[model samples]
Target: MARLRRFLDRIEPQFQKGGPYEKYFALYEMVDTFIYSPADVTRGSPHVRDAIDLKRVMSYVVVATFPVLLLMLWNTGFQANNAISQMGMTGLDGWRNWVMSTLGIAHDPNSVFANMFYGLLYFLPMYITTLVAGGIFEVIFAAVRNHEVNEGFLVSSMLYTLTLPPSTPLWMVALGIIFGVVLGKEVFGGTGKNFLNPALTGRAFLYFAYPAAMSGDAVWTAVDGYTGATPLALAASGGIDAVKEAGYSWSQTFLGVMPGSLGETSTLAILIGAAFLIYTRVANFRIILGVFLGMVATSLLFNLIGSDTNPMFSVPWYWHLTMGGLAFGMVFMATDPVSAAMTNKGRWIYGALIGFMAVMIRVVNPAFPEGIMLAILFGNIFAPLIDYFVVQANIKRRMKRS
Candidate 1:
């Protein structure tokens, strides 16, 4: 502690007199030494240290994302059961919906459990394939780089799986994760060094690679025969007229009674996960709050602008947050510390821009109803630039004051 203080004391003058800058500089120095302790072991530092580890960082992320995983299990199961009922396959020659329904607490063979279990059965293979493939890549990278396998991918894999539709093929999942791990994380120098979240990279890869599995009428539902369109897709396809006739209720949407990705359908579950994340301090509330504000504001502006073709433009700005992956993405992906803007000031802009871009892309690009994935990936790439400009602007202001 004394050594760190002495080191900071030496460099403090270069930053400024006693102020937040000095304080932040000191904090950065402390974290730099502590977080970068591995470098000290190799580089022979002044031998100052503190208590912190990669496990602690990764634990926070796991803890934060736990709610999301639980919600995914329930929602996926629920959707699968509902789809089965619609297809009248709840009772088959060699049916298993009875057991599924009993366990998940949904009575009708076509109830929540039937759906949840069906979706889970289908999605689990894809999820496992992705993790295994991505894990192999991670291990190879770690072996070649001679660094410990970082904890970053643990949460990334989970997030990636959660974002996927239950029906995505296992092979496609494996390929996507491979692309994500190799291109997104490994190529960028592994783990914390990556610019974009690796999981999103995987999702993006699959989206581009297998647009059929990634989207369209079949991917959202668990049933073999029935055509299940995602709420966003339904809205996009038929606009307000299609959705109004379908009578997509708010309750159904909140309870995950809709066709969509594994975890994104349940606003209720996502909110629960959001609360858990915020409570654990794994995510920044300010960034989340600011991003919500930006999304709401931007959505309102677009809604007010009055699109002539899409009467659903009047579907209330609040719905944007609940629909699609906006809730999950904001709570988990956009707030990733490594990829996010470093400066506090930059976070506001970074988050806001992500929110804006997400909504804009979703509305403007009919082909893609879920835009948060690409938007956050874009934000991650531009984070450093945002921070750089923010710092440069601060420097200029300080110099001008002088």
Candidate 2:
């Protein structure tokens, strides 16, 4: 550790102002700060200092995602292996199968090692594509704008990769991330200044632009020609009965053993991550509580107004909590500090809006079964207005007291 620090210190002058590599200072600083905390400090008065910096905050989020990441790998492989077994095939027809065969790993769903390893093959490629494509944009923007490269992309890339279907094309992965970083964020002034979540922005672009690839029964499982509807999609079509007929129970959905997007499937895993974030104060608990209450209230209302036509109207609030990306988005996306409402009271409104809209879209709109992505984006758009009203109300109350 000492040797590495000394090495960085020795080469620091070469990247400083007026040096030959001065233009690449952003690149240098990115690597340096990533490995060690910055040496620079404020010397002036009236500056409040804290032990936690941006890097630590971002790193904590990445760390919190560990439980979700593990489940994503295990569940992805389990689904694929289980599908292949049902199809009566020995293995897939590509390199993945070849590697598994050489490694003596069978297509057995019960084998924990086999499931995780097989899932890694699917996950690693997409993650690498996201990192390379998104990192290039981050570096380019930092170099052009003459600012230190922010650590936010680390979180964005991981979150975006988790949202994608395992079989998503490598090219589409690159294109989606590029669109996300450039338009969703950079166009609005990057990272903390952006009004939208960059990860969701790119995902939304792909959802609209390439609808066939993004959704439907074919995309969830990695095996080609295997068609399986997510529990939420099943509920959308045949109500809770359809999901049960397809062999998905509330417990299965809750544990995330069923088919869906990689990280979004497991409510248990998402909650684990949420607990850590809330404990560390990285995520706002009010927003989480508000989202939960709003979802329960709306879902219960729909249940009361039972629809003879739409089965989705019968889904209970607890089922809604376990299904799809509701839990995942409530914990991660709605709590984004920059995009969420700033005022304390506004956080409640913002979260409720997301929760309400998510259920509304899932039940009322037959076209789209899952609604968290659109709901969070909607909340992000209205966050500023929500905050504005909150501020005005507070001012009026204070003035009356005076």
Candidate 3:
């Protein structure tokens, strides 16, 4: 450690202003600050600060996201193996399988290790693709704009990787992240100034642009020719019994034994991550509580309205939580500090509106099975407005009282 500090100190001057390496200082500083906190101090007055900086916040969120990431690795492999086994493939199938097959590892659906290994093969490539693409864009923007490369992309890239379908092609992965980082965040003046969650924004673009690849049961399961409707898709067609008929109990769904997005299938895993965030104060409980409250009230209202036509009308709040991307979005995406409402009152309202709209869209419209993506984006758009109203209301009441 002492040697590292001395080494950095020795060469650090080269990257300083007017030095030989000053042009690449942003890149050098990114690595240097990552290893140790910057020695630069407050240069002027009005320097309000908190113990938590952007890096700390990003690190906490990334830590909270790991449970889901671990589970996604297992689940992605499990789904692929299950589908392959159903089609009677005892051997490796994909490019990953073929590569690992040489190493004496067969694609055995029953083997936990095999499933996890296969899942890793899929997850690692996509993750690398996202990191590389996003990093390039981040560095380019930082260099041109003359700012330090923000660590926010670490969180964004990971979040984006987890949300994707396992069957997504490498090209699409690169393209989606390019769109996400540049348009979603950079266009609005980079990370802190962005109005949208960059990961979801990129995903939404892929979803609308490449509907064939993004939607339906074909993409959900990795093995070709294996068709399986997700729990939400089943409920939309024939209500809760259909989900049971498909052999998924609430317990299975909660524990993440369903086919869907890589990380979003497991409610329990998502909650575990959520608990970490809440405990660490990386996420706000008031917003989470409001989302659940809105989900409960809206689902109950739909139950009374009782659609004789749509089976989704009978889907309860509990089901809503475990099914689809609701749990994942509520925990990670909804709590994004930059896009979410800032004020206490606005947080509650913003969260509630997201929850309510998610359920409303899921039940009322069968076109979109999962509404969390759109709901959070919608909430992001309205968050500033919600905060403004809350702030204005407080100002008015205080002025009147005075």
Most lDDT-accurate candidate: 2
lDDT of 2 at 208: 99
Tens digit per residue, CA lDDT, model 1, 1-402:
678667856766655666547647666655555433333332211111212355545656677665666667666766666566566664442234454545554424345444446556666676688779989999998899887775667787888888888777677778888998899878977766778788898899888987877888887765566576766777676664565577677677776667788777777777777787688666778678767878888888878887877644655666777778888898888988778887879889999999988888877887787788999998988989999999999999999999
TM per model?
0.81, 0.89, 0.88
Please count the clashing residue pairs in each candidate, in the order shown.
7, 0, 0
Q: What is the lDDT of residue 168 in candidate 2?
A: 97
For 1-402, candidate 3 gives per-residue lDDT tens digits of: 789989988998999998999999899877777656566632221101224467757877888878887778788888888887778866545678777678777667788888889889988999999999889999999898977776789998988988898889989999999999999999887868888999999999999999888889888888777888889999999999899999999998898888888889999988998898899787988889888898899999999899889999999889999999999999999998888898889989999999999998999888997998999999999999998999999999999999
For residues 1-402, write the lDDT of model 2, one tens digit per residue: 899999989998989999889999999998887667677622221101223567756887898899999999999999999999899986368999999999999999999999999999999999999999999999999788876786789999999999999989999999999999999888776767788989999999999999999999999999999999999999999999999998999999999998888899999999999999999888889999889988999999999999999999999998999998899999988998878988889999999999999999999999998998999999999999999999999999999999
Regions of candidate 3 where Cα sits further than 4 Å from its true position: 1-51, 90-93
For model 2 the local lDDT of residue 76 reads 99
- Model 2 weakest lDDT span, ten residues long: 41-50
By TM-score, how accurate is candidate 2? 0.89
Q: RMSD, each candidate, Å?
A: 10.4, 6.0, 5.6
RMSD versus native structure for model 2: 6.0
Q: Give candidate 2's total backbone clashes.
A: 0
